[model samples]
Target: MMSSTFLVMRERVVAAIMSNPVVGPDSAGTLARMNDPSQNCTFEELGFDSLARMEFCIFLETEFGISLSSGEIEASPSINAMAAYLAGEG
Candidate 1:
């Protein structure tokens, strides 16, 4: 069973991914996959280029008020992983 905090963080992470201009609102297919909690989508699978990766990291740092490096984000690599890590950091 998942905790409420982790669930909230997961939703926030998905929301951030959707809202990022780099991800673009037009990628509806990828967005849908991301919304499904059962799926484990990697940033690379979502077509997150280097620039988008940096933008995502910046968005996360600003949104969550936590310092995060690309290395840390890379270590996480999926919505669930990122959310779980951030839940602890938050």
Candidate 2:
């Protein structure tokens, strides 16, 4: 079962993605799909490229007050994956 903390983190990740100016408006549907726990879509499919991915990593770091290695960012490329990584389950 998924922990409540992880679930909340997932929601926060989705919210962050939605608020990102660079990739938000264009991928609103993808962001909405991220709310589904079963979804595991990649950033590329959601219209995010390397620069957008880096920007998102920066956003997550600032929002969570945590530093993320490039490997960590690459490893957690989806909303659920990112939530797991943030929750220390990655």
Candidate 3:
């Protein structure tokens, strides 16, 4: 089971992805898919190349006030895993 904190962070993480210009386009279809909780996709599945990953890391650092390496993000690739990892960090 996921903690409340994890669940909330998961939503925020999804929101972050949706807001990412490189990873997510401003398309309704993409937003709909992103909103679907069942669609827990890895960064690769979301078409994240090295540049996108680095940009997202910068975004995360700015948004969460926490520094994370690309390797760390790659390790916890999915939203759920990332959220859990972040919740633990908190």
Candidate 4:
């Protein structure tokens, strides 16, 4: 089972992804796939190229008030991994 904190973090991450112009409406299906806890969806798998990853990193820093280096983002590419990272940071 996932912790409530993790679940909340996951939702925030998904919201950030959805808010990206690059990931707008057309990526709805990819977003849906991301919501699945059973799957480990990486940035690449979700169609987030280099620029999208940078955007996502900026989103996380702005929304979560946490700094993440490109290396950190690369190290934790999946939403679940990012959520776990946030949990650890908290």
Model 1 accuracy (lDDT, Cα): 0.75
Model 2 off-target regions past 4 Å? 25-29
Per residue, candidate 4 scores C-alpha lDDT tens digits across 1-90 of 788888888887777777766753356576567777655567667677777777877887888886777677778787889877877743
Candidate 1 scores a C-alpha RMSD against the true structure in Å of: 2.6
**Which pairs of residues collide in model 1?**
none
> Relative to the unseen true structure, what is the C-alpha lDDT of residue 53 in candidate 4, on a scale of 0 to 100?
72
TM-score of each: 0.78, 0.77, 0.78, 0.77
Off by over 4 Å in 4: 24-29
CA displacement after TM-score superposition, residue 60 of candidate 3 (Å): 1.4
What C-alpha lDDT do the candidate models reach, one value each?
Answer: 0.75, 0.73, 0.75, 0.73
Q: Where does the lowest 10-residue lDDT sum fall in candidate 3?
A: 25-34
Candidate 1 lands at a TM-score of 0.78
Give the per-residue lDDT digits (tens) of candidate 1, residues 11-68: 8778767777887434667677777776657776766776777878777778877677
True-vs-predicted CA distance for residue 19, candidate 1, Å = 1.9
User: What are the clashing pairs of model 2?
Assistant: none
